[model samples]
Target: MGQPLAPPPVAGDLSDRLVATDVWTDGMLAEHGIPVVDVPLVTFGGGIGSFVTADYLRICGVPTSAIRVLTPLETPWQSYEYLTTVSQIPRTERLRSDSASTPDNIWGFPSYALREGLQGDLKQLWNVLVEPIWANYYTPRAGAAFTAMEKEMHRIRYPEMVVRGQVRMVRRRAGGGYFTILTPPQGAAPTRRIAYRSQWVHVAVGYPGLKFLDDLQEYRKQTNDYGSVVNAYEPHEHVYEKLRAKPGVVLVRGGGIVASRVLQRLIDDRDRFRLDTQIVHLFRTYTATPHGTGILKRRKGADGWAYQGFNYPKSVWGGQLKQQVRKTEGAERARLYKEMGGTNTPVRRDWQEQLSRGRAQGWYRVMIGQIDRMTKTGELVEVAVASDQGPQLGSFDAVVDCTGLEADIREHRVLADLLDHSGAGRNPVGRLDVERTFEVRGTRNGNGRIYASGSATLGGYFPGVDTFLGLQIAAQEIADDLHAQGFGSKLGPGRSTSQWWKWFRNQQI
Candidate 1:
């Protein structure tokens, strides 16, 4: 999140010959003194997406020695937790995800709600049963998801497959398979660079980095005041700490889930401390009414918020929208993404009540406008707005930017290198293009494949490629593809039942 995680050093790590070649040869890597390790399947990114894929393969009888996870993270959920915590959805707070979107359980049986009920939280189970009717959709807390993942991670012996390093690039092999170059934590290996030779390469690097609005970027660049203007995705607990010490006006931008969480945190503190902290919410495009492409696809909107229980429509998972996107191409695919994609937040009763109270008390204010610019005003931040009403301006003690995931795939060095040196292409929505089976299209080399998942493959045939359940779906597809390629056993009904039992019993695979 800070400084874009400095790209892997290149000066002494790569050789001229290796750098110049598009397809890498084993001999070439050896000649350059780059240690080559052979693994049948290699997946980088080491996040939840990568973990899901590896977990599926392991359950299908793939041995740990045959798979490798190259990443800089200490754990699969490290980045996810950091982002959620900073965005104000700490361990105790519920996530904006469905109860069944369990990354740990591939079958999604005994869902989060079921588990919660087993643990004495029958209210959550009831919430899911009557979701969007008598109650809001049930969501798992951040801690529950993480704890479950930790158990699965060990059950699958995921740690054994992990190779802690920063992936630099993936190139097609001269004969077959691919060569994945990794920058080992300085001195972790004899060579600066380690080349992983694998028949299949899976990429799930998630988002390249956090996105800051142009006005916020310029404000910080000009004033060098990061403390006052912070991205909700970054560590900014100090902002709340300072506000607790004194009553102040805080400006919040964006209309997504994070904005909701941040607002709740601010109001929660104000109530707990009996402080008079005022909140100014700015919505670029206020949704005052229901909006959608058609009557059947309409989303609920009101009070300057577009309400969605989850990130995408439920149909996108396997319903009409999924079928539509899979069959569509080019402009049609792009249009579908545009029609469905937008910033929205789930409707929570507690937060809604808090917001309503604040509104009535005249402590919460909503404005509709795009920021013209921002400037320093002593310890406060002055934001100029341009909206339908007219130009306006205000000053606040702090500005919390909640907009996120706007960075392009090319912003990531490895992804850029994949496009430039490898044969990877972009989808209609400008992310890494992939086949229905999640293989990176056009990058296939004899008998080998380069598969990708997660946000990087967002615009592919799958519309929900960025969610927890989405990752599991991609893993299923990719695992099936590998099975067809004679890598792992097929997950037939018998095998699936056995694996689910093993999972339920917490038995090691």
Candidate 2:
């Protein structure tokens, strides 16, 4: 996590358009006498945002081979999978989409749960309650959608290479554009720097990787149980595997979306695998008075929200509150955001019913407090909770924190270097602050146009841009920028009937 890397010695310089037009790749170009000037549309986080942008670019004739999706092969939904399929994935977990959130089509294929109702059953119910048309926004099967994206990867053969090295930094090239440096696997010295010089640089480095608390990091710094105590997002196969072997008390922290999903996942395990798992949910907010009005029980959690809102009520999305938030500053803005919401979704009634049933059954319960300390017992964990009643001690066979994901760009040294040397500055929201076009707002002397999108840009002008729709919107804006710069033409109204039919025929139902 240092300054942007110094420019690689330019042996045989080349242009970006040449990189795009070539059947010869970076590997092949070097094989010949030509140098591979990496294409401009290099997307760092090759998740949905990258996929949509790459897909649009490809069909619009921006040959898939030119776009390099530089990311770990794990799909964008890995964080999501751990919560939904708490035990094993049930194909039946219907998506809660409205009529327009289908993954099959980006721009036009806006089908909802109800649209799938024409097919049949509990699914139809899913459509009406979850996927009805013009209904509230819903979350689709993030995993399945990501799987579908991988297929698109194969179809387009997007970019001939995905260098395994992690980017440490991206700096402006001596001549123009930007120069990205990567840290290869442990022992590779020769190819330490994989230079990507482009006219336009997209820093779509999604949400920063998860960064735990000082205590957690301190524990990790001191001992090795860091693996035993998992960050809610990372790989924790052992936690579940352990639960499978023995039925014991598992403590779950946080009341956010992940917490709720994790709760259901535990319940799913109980029903599917017949594991009589006991769970305790730790919530910071005690329902003194419901936070919502009438039917909407707007109960606040922790620092904000007395009722249901992502972090704030929907009114914040469309009403005067958004403008008010715009005028706020410093602690006021943070307080305003706090007053709105964090990442918690409303307690979906279905999941709520399941938890309620579990509580009635005596298998599930809740704790109103926060973790004050932790110590390892022989085969369990000793947790001290700071409750309103007083300090209380509890023991758990395991602890799963449903705290959401919040990563810093510096988690990877290469990206850290990019920020240090490339002149990139964070936006007001504390994530990558980019211009309207999604380009990172680097210093005036900063190399090439480095833009960021997806969760990283949530602190930007648009709200909910971290969602799938947001990714697509960012891609469209980025693509428009590239098009204006003469990268290529975007496919729109001018399509022939045959081509339109071809695009339509390829959609998912």
Candidate 3:
């Protein structure tokens, strides 16, 4: 067996002390001299999900002062941009996300295609119009999405509400509301932790953290050499740079989008620099045909990737699939989720052509198996694979694992605290359980409601709960729930139109 996994770092001593308390009273906090700031809403994990919700509330006439976004990120898209860039999707590259899933605009009116068309990219518009039948699905550029979100961020005055810190845990206040503890960066504040008391708490902590495979972790721990075995999410630019300097063989593990992008990057470098680089792709499950539960839902599959336009079937956003999932619960819902879930990537022609060329030239090879063991042997690494053809061994300059699986929610300090002390339970699929309105079902404290979006709350009611469109939908639901409770103005046609006009004019609210 591989080396046992190491424990994650604790949030802080404050988290240990706070986890035992179910409710915190004003007197209790006052005794410790902890400053408590009051706000109508407090959103943690200030990524795209938090930004979308804040944008919705702002559009509904909520003031910046009424909301507090507690996060450590310098910018809303900083985490997302980092992941994409390290995974080979530079600012110039297009994301696999759908064009119409605009996080900046809730209505998704004048989709990315229309915007690109007006900007003189008629090819994009045409491609979107024809879609799967004629042309491959179109996606917005990584930079374009970030640029749009930045514009929305300014229009909503998101910067004014940002509290730069890492959230420890949220505790229910004795009287009402919730106390969200934030640990500000060193030198940013005098206090060790600041507490924000809010009637509504929104948690959008995107993916708890990345999980490197056990074997890879074991190898790194034993040899203390991180250069040979690396994860795609982390910075491994040195791998490519070294390849550019000299001929090398790269063993790429996993068959997801990151794998395809890494392969493309390697091929591009090979063609551009006239370098002799060989690529070996390892797939756990190699698919050879279309797959799905129903005839109408078949997804294209070849080699290993289960190809789809988006992460989930587009129908999950609004059609029958959405309704089906919303109505089901427990085992049925989990079954449906399993049917829709798989590692998939959009079928891009350029990448496919490059792979075809690599195959024809014999520089690229596909292997069906997983790395059983990896050992550093001199300058190269020896990788043992347990394949259908029996045990196989290979030596490569570097082994890049592209399996993009996030660690368990419990790995996140705040999430773990929520599960242990805040009455937040796990859903059928083991993530945070949430209501239809994206509210943590049992996490209501008095009149206050705890809402959540993003990856942490997946498997509740939506299949695409982690996507851009999914986050927007969750934001709308949470906003609507808040509006019902008289927190913000109703975003009816008039308000939506006026705010949309402001967005169009690039005017800050």
Candidate 4:
């Protein structure tokens, strides 16, 4: 019942569009010198992953003001929320979760929704809804929750000391600790000559950004126009906007969650705005028919998941296969990631039902195939699809590639440099190898630990560490590690109680 998530504004002047402009200005940079100041801890990626890490460190007694959340900040989930909600992740959509999941709200405190419910007649529902109790990962408006996490970052003051910049590179200090170099925004130069040296560094720059398929990447490079074709994870507003302007079929390429959400958005627009947006979903695998029986229905689809499971499959969560994954490494890990959760699929049921009805009604159709060639003519795209239907031919108004995402560490210069020059190593899954605690695993070049979270750890040992809850879990682990090493303990249990009494004395709710 909260505000519907705002559709992402088209990218304009980025300076004007992004929030917290003051966090990274030339003046502040000019004010601080290159004098190597030593801080107890540092975390990578100024997103929820780092936010939670900082939060836990604060609770553990490290002054909230002591930690530096190093990264650019438009907001946590800034890109992802845009990708999901604008595409098809709706506000009311129910989440497909691991049964017990919370985003960065890892302390199991309440959100606006849970808090509101706590004051209602359905208080049982409220407590039941509270995560880590009865509620597993069935998230509601998961996208909204992600945006809400930004408020947590601000509320807890994690961003109080945010350095508005991307970490360009890092090098292990000769004696101990590490130094991280950064690239501030285009105009923020006076501070450009600054570096942060710390005893600990936690890397969470989630999967080296985005890696589209070779064919899709080639197509995008060739077209350089996102008018008729678009990648699901990026700003491809023109595709749907074009469909809105001219009513024709939108061929969504992928069998994953993004594809599902994109299709739903098209359907909703078609129904609500009266846009004649027909949709043709091109899934490489034909799942129009159920293939398995029992509780296993969610596993047999592909990737060891029951054909009915959401986002890879339920088994990816603590099931037998997940345990097997823990035992396996190298090619096995890569194969596991490929099989489970590698594909994108929306995690809502009503959308699935809607698409099913569309299939029944003919307004929506499904073709299991891959695109062989795409030629855009005037207002339409001639698509040659390779399918069991004997090489089907179709013309669509636009194609949205929801082919999921992959971020090769090599693409991220900081990680690559660390791997090559700084003595870091890739784990069994071919990512920045880190211990279970989220510390990047390589011979100790210094006391500072380089860790990663988000999509980068997709192939790591933890089950759902790549998701929101996973981010918090990684943060908790990192905070615990830092605490064990004696740092970031501002809000330990004692301090938390003190704050509670302070709130009570203020008569604050």
Candidate 5:
């Protein structure tokens, strides 16, 4: 019989062009004319989490050439700044982040409070000193945080290691290590995709993406109107802009820091322009008083919003709660996370006063409910909410959803790929599971170790895994783990002190 004819080459056949399986070898890829760049480590999601990790590694003497950062952002804080500004925290406004959680300085020395004090802001200094007692905990300005991160980024020469692109997925290589496939922007690179082969991989993709409720998404889809119902994370400056231009009523959803900021902005506009603006704040779980499972662990709440100095109990950063969480596993760890997790905002006196005045003046109202449905009524939106009192209907100019839950990690292509193809499992809390070292469990491919941090790895040993301080802590743990694997020098006190001195001196590595 005649030899069977070979099948024709298919268009966009990634089997030869991409590393889709653990069986893909460097020789196989090279034979197909695909380029492979080898590096000791590669970090995806070059946000503050990646910056902090790179910062620690650089301090430990890791060269720029040995590491690669795959990110689509031009700067580390671009995504953060976008969220903060849209949620009413302009550059000059204070962030909800604590003063001590300085992402730029790993040692947390010369905290934001101290920096403000040095600049003649004695009031902020006092506030920090008496925080959670006589006064609310003080936080740093958004601009200060961004500027500090920028300085550290340059100092570490992080930009030199950044490869701008969207990370498609990570696949295990046959010989060893892992191949991280990145889809570079069109016209930016010669190839449609680029692969980075590395022994160590760190994933810090931040929040998967801001989640808009199903109802809001549906309303937008059916009506094709993007103006009326908006998420706090997106660019909704027009919502406030139009409100400032004329009188209007806005329904603010969720009871987190973003909600507080949104309310403050509305009240500020009302007070400044003397415009008749009404705000209706909605909460899913209304906290009424000091509530908790234990006396010493009580959280303060009132007027529908729970108040806390920070996101998690400070004890989670250290002390008994930290130990309690670290030792727990599976369901127990998830339960502990639930006990401490809830939407809470710092008790800022100014916003509180604004809210109080608003309530007394009948311009602001609070309702405990979930949005049942929403329909566009001309330029306004008619909302039906299932409240504790019962079903209620309201019409508002705009609805701002401030619920900042990271959409399921699977929403991101890379994270979804990790779960489906890399044998990575989710913790009981439904976030990426990791070991005490922040090493992603079950993704060990030969000598390569996959580590994760930031919001995606929240269910690991740390409760504050998404915060700035949490990122720093995660970085330290990952750095230590890498050091143990003989990748970089261990950051003992002596080395840390010397490196800190260089930082203080404004010396570059």
Candidate 6:
């Protein structure tokens, strides 16, 4: 061995006192050399979820000093933009969100389409007006959304509330409330960890981590080769760059939105560079017809793809599905999620046309199968698949896995600690359980409460918990709950209108 490996800094950073105690005391923290930073509320993740909650609270008249945002990300959109970009959705590309799903503006009156129309892009306005029927649904460009969020971030003074650090764990306090352990970057603090004592804690960590297919994970582990196989969510520009350099066979996996974007990017590159790249698509389950529980709830499916305008049915936002989920409990809610959820992509005209052309040109091929094994063969990866036709094996220059996220919330350290120590429970779908008000069930410590939103709290009452609008709805519920606890002012009609004007004028709060 080169040298003996050094032990992790867990002992020094997260003291034995902090780790052993389910309920923390200030005295114990003091003894452990942990400095306590007191704030009324603490929200971790520092992503869009935290930003939206902070925005809603600020609009409801909560001061920045009363709230603290603990996160490693500098901006709310940092992680989101990175994911989108790696998945081939750059600033110029459109996001698969509704025009009204504005994370920056809660009112959503001057929607993306309206704003675009004001800026002389009348096509988006027309597209939204007669969408899905006359034309495909209109979506906002990624740049516009990020720019709006930046404006709102400055207006709300979000930076003031930000404490740059990675949150290690959260524990219930002795008297009431919670103590969150934050491990600041190296040399940023006197100690390795700082304790945040707060009455309420909000968890908005999106997904635990990326989920690699079993076969792909095994291949990577064996060969230690990340270049040949890649997840669509990660930075895999080399895949496309290699294609541009020379024509090659590529396998496009999954049938989700990211899969569509990846395919679109591949086809776009072929068209632009005049390359002879052959595209092979693999779908585990081929959808040849429409699918749903009922005619009213049916989603259009064809050509091995389920087409939807948004992530979930629009009804889940504020309609029948919302009410149905809110009223149900346990298995019924799980059943609803199963019926509504699956791999799907929106129908985009450009991609459809490009795919249709590729089909005619005999460069694009679709295979219905699950990978039995993946092996690196020379410069290419060989994949053995169990398909509808029978067993098949193929070799390609690259394999792009565009499957879903990590299902288990316990993969994240903080969430796992919550389950083990903070008395948090899992919902039917195996994520953090939360009430209608977004308060994490079973995590209440005295007068303090822990609220969770975003992907970690999916499968709760909200079916649209992962979307921008869904996050806003969660923030509203949280703000209302805080108001009930006499923390923030109520967001009444008068206040809403006044705040809307302030947002319009870009006035700092």
Off by over 4 Å in 6: 1-12
Q: Any idea what lDDT model 2 has?
A: 0.58
What are the TM-scores, per candidate, against the unseen true structure? 0.97, 0.76, 0.96, 0.79, 0.95, 0.97
Q: What overall lDDT goes with each candidate model?
A: 0.90, 0.58, 0.89, 0.62, 0.87, 0.91
Compared with the true structure, what per-residue lDDT tens digits does model 1 show for residues 99-209?
Answer: 888999999899999999999988988888899899988989999999999999999999999999999999999899999999999888877888899999999999977
Scored against the true structure, residue 322 in model 5 reaches a CA lDDT of 87
Ranking according to lDDT, highest score first: 6, 1, 3, 5, 4, 2
Q: Please identify which of the two predictions, 2 or 5, would achieve the higher lDDT against the true structure.
A: 5
Give the range of the ten consecutive residues with the poorest summed lDDT in model 5.
4-13
How many clashing residue pairs appear in each of the predictions shown?
Answer: 0, 34, 0, 35, 0, 0
Instruction: State which candidate has the highest lDDT.
Output: 6
The 10 consecutive residues of candidate 2 with the worst lDDT sum are: 17-26
Q: Each prediction's Cα RMSD?
A: 4.3, 6.9, 5.2, 9.9, 2.7, 4.0
lDDT of 4 by residue, 216-308 (tens): 666657667456777787777677677777778888887766666677778877888887678887878665333544454433343211233
Summing lDDT over every window of 10 consecutive residues in candidate 1, give the lowest-scoring window.
Answer: 1-10
Off by over 4 Å in 2: 1-38, 74-99, 102-104, 108-115, 118-139, 154-165, 182-190, 214-228, 272-276, 287-336, 443-447, 490-492, 495-500, 507-509
In Å, residue 80's CA in model 6 sits off its true spot by 0.6
The residue-level lDDT of candidate 5 at 309 comes to: 79
Per-residue lDDT for 430 in model 6?
A: 92
TM-score (C-alpha) between model 6 and the true structure: 0.97
Provide the global lDDT of candidate 4 against the true structure: 0.62
lDDT string for model 5 (167-275, tens) is 8888888767898887788878766667789999999999997777788889989999898888888889899888988889999999999898888888888988898
